[model samples]
Target: MGKSSTSVLVILAFFAIYVIWGSTYLLNKVAVQELEPFMLASCRFTTAGILIFILAKIMGIPLSITKKQLWNTIIAGILFLSFGNGVVVWALKYVDSGFAALEISAQPLIILLLMRVLQGKKIQPMSVIGVILGIVGIYLLVSQKQIIAKEESITGMVMIFFCMLSWAYGSLFVAKADLPNNYFVNTGYQMFTAGITLALMSLAFGETWSAPLSWSGGVQLSMVLLIVFGSILAFTSFNYLLKAVSPEKVATSTYVNPIVALLLGWYFLDEQITAQSIIAATILLTGVYFINTKKTLAIFERFKR
Candidate 1:
């Protein structure tokens, strides 16, 4: 592919993770309300995995992968999907989707710290400032009296934190790992294996499985969107971005995701948007901006002399 084509794809992939993934917070919340968390995740991913494979085959893309690549894909699947996203969906049972998205806005901060510790990368002066702000933002966001009052919400928030850790590690892993060259195949293998893993988890937990046809209309619709957009498009874009841009820059999706999720949750789901949430979101996003501004790719850099 030409530099121009790659640049265009990069832009589109970023958009997928930013805008499309933002809406998934609400979509997952909707499905989790009526369906078992792991089961819902399992069905969604398995269906998406099958669809992705089918689409790839139809496009004459090769599905062959080396054993090492397959293993890496499974590991990636477990980290990114089975535990990272599936567990987050489960946590949505206790926390409002918008609130969860806001808390997760600290991801870029986590990724930066991981890079510092794991890769011995030096944090720039501005990044230190961003770190301080991110810490403050997180403290403010989680310290709300109303939020702290609910034990369920507290548990959900804690689980989400660990889920973030899993995703952060997965992001770092993907950047360096050798995997299938095709983004679609990479994502398909990950989703398929992760879906199987989630299915096992659901059965172990004694969660009853229900057919998609039996789910409520809203849940059914949400599952369709989740499978098609969230699992396929957004996730493929995520893998593509991991390879195209730096991990910290990819994590900037959190900045826009929370805003999209917050509005959708408020408008469609009647979720509360507290003053504290607004303030925390501002601080968190500001911190993310400071951390990423220097690293962000110029859209027209390829064309520049």
Candidate 2:
């Protein structure tokens, strides 16, 4: 691909990740009302995993890997897909889509702290301030009675918090861990492993499989959306961006997702955007800027040497 073409693809990929993946939050919220949440996620991922595996096979992309690489990918899949994404899917059953988006926006803040603690990365002064500001924003956003007062919703929030932490750690791990370079292979294994784990969990949890399909059209549509938009398109673009952009730049999508999700929620569901949400979004985006943009510019300046 030419440089311009690559740039355009990157931009498109970012948009897919930002907009499509963001919309999944609300979709999940609506879908869960008609389906078992974990089962819903398992079905989505299983289908996506199968499609990716098929694509990889048809393209003759090497899917075989060393034992070490297999183990690493499996671990990442468990942490990211099963725990991280699974939690969010389950939470949608109890939380509003817009509120869920706000809570999930905390991932970048979690990533900053995890990098400093786990990877021995320096916590820049501005980044520290950003984390603090982001947390305050999340607090304000989630303090609404609609979000916090419901016991099931509160449990969902806690699960989502852990989900963010797991996902943050998984991202850093992917950066540092030895793995295959082919995005298809890496993503294929991750989805397959995650899908299997989630499916098993869903079965163990006694999620009934006897439910009629037509009665759950919304859930079926949500699953299709997740597989096509969320898993296949968004994920592939994101992994491609990882190679083309700085890790920090790729991380910016985390912040961008909530903005997209909030907007989509308002448009489709007529969800109100409150002053608290706007304020929280500003703080969160500002924090993401500090964590990603400042560091990226600093690194580029050093590269000019």
Candidate 3:
């Protein structure tokens, strides 16, 4: 593809990650109203996985990964999807989707800390400052009077924190681990493994699928949207962007998603957007910007010197 064509595709991919993934938080909130969290996740991933697998096969993508790669992919899948995503789905029962998005926005900071601790990666001073600011933002968000007024909201926030941690670890692990060169094949296997695991978890938790059959149109539509837009399109776009653009540029989705989620939640679900939320979001996103954009900032500082 020409440079211009690639640029357009990159921009489209950014839209998928920023808007579509952001929308999934609310869609998941709607889905869990009728479908249990694990069950809902299972269905969404299974459907998306199957479709992606078929597409990969048709595209002649190599699927012959080693046994170690398979096992690593499965482990990453469980961490990223079954735990990271499934837990968030369950927590959305108690937390507003907007708040869940805000909490998840701390993921880049968490990933930096994990890399520093687990891999002995040296964090820049500015990044450390960013991490500190992010923590304070989280505290402010969770300690809001409205959030503290409800015990369930506190519990939900705690669960979302764990969810973010799992996602960060999974991201780091997948990046380091050996996997197939083909992004579509890798994603297909991961989603398939996660889907099967979530299905078993749903059965273990005694969740039934009957509720979805009788769900309202809105809830049913949300499920379809989650499977199509959230899983298939957005995930494929993200995988493409990983190759097409700088990781730092792709990481900007973490900053954009929460804002989109918050606005959608307010408009569609009537989720409250208090002054506290605005202040907290500002602080949190500022920290994220610093952390992700550290490389560019360093270059600018050097030029000044």
Give candidate 2 regions above 4 Å deviation: 1-5, 210-212, 295-305
Please state every model's RMSD to the true fold in angstroms.
3.1, 2.7, 3.7
Q: lDDT of all predictions, in order shown? A: 0.90, 0.78, 0.82
How does model 1 score by TM-score?
0.96
Worst 10 residues of 1 by lDDT: 296-305
lDDT of 2 at 273: 88
* Candidate 1: segments with Cα more than 4 A from true spot: 295-305
Please tell me which predicted candidate would have the highest TM-score against the true structure.
1
Count clashing residue pairs per candidate.
0, 0, 0
Evaluation by TM-score, superior candidate among 1 and 2:
1
Model 2: per-residue lDDT, tens digit, 191-292?
Answer: 888888998999989996545466467766777788888888887776676566655556667677888888888998788888888998888888876766
TM-score per prediction, in order, is 0.96, 0.90, 0.90
Q: Model 2, residue 57: displacement in angstroms?
A: 2.0
Query: lDDT tens digits, residues 1-305, model 3?
Result: 79999889888989999999999988998778777899999988888889888887888876789999899879977987899899899999999999999988878788777867986767787787788888988888888998999999989999999988898787666655677677777777778899999999999999877656788899889988988899888877876665555443465687778898999999998999989888889998888657756585464234223
- Candidate 2, position 12, lDDT: 94
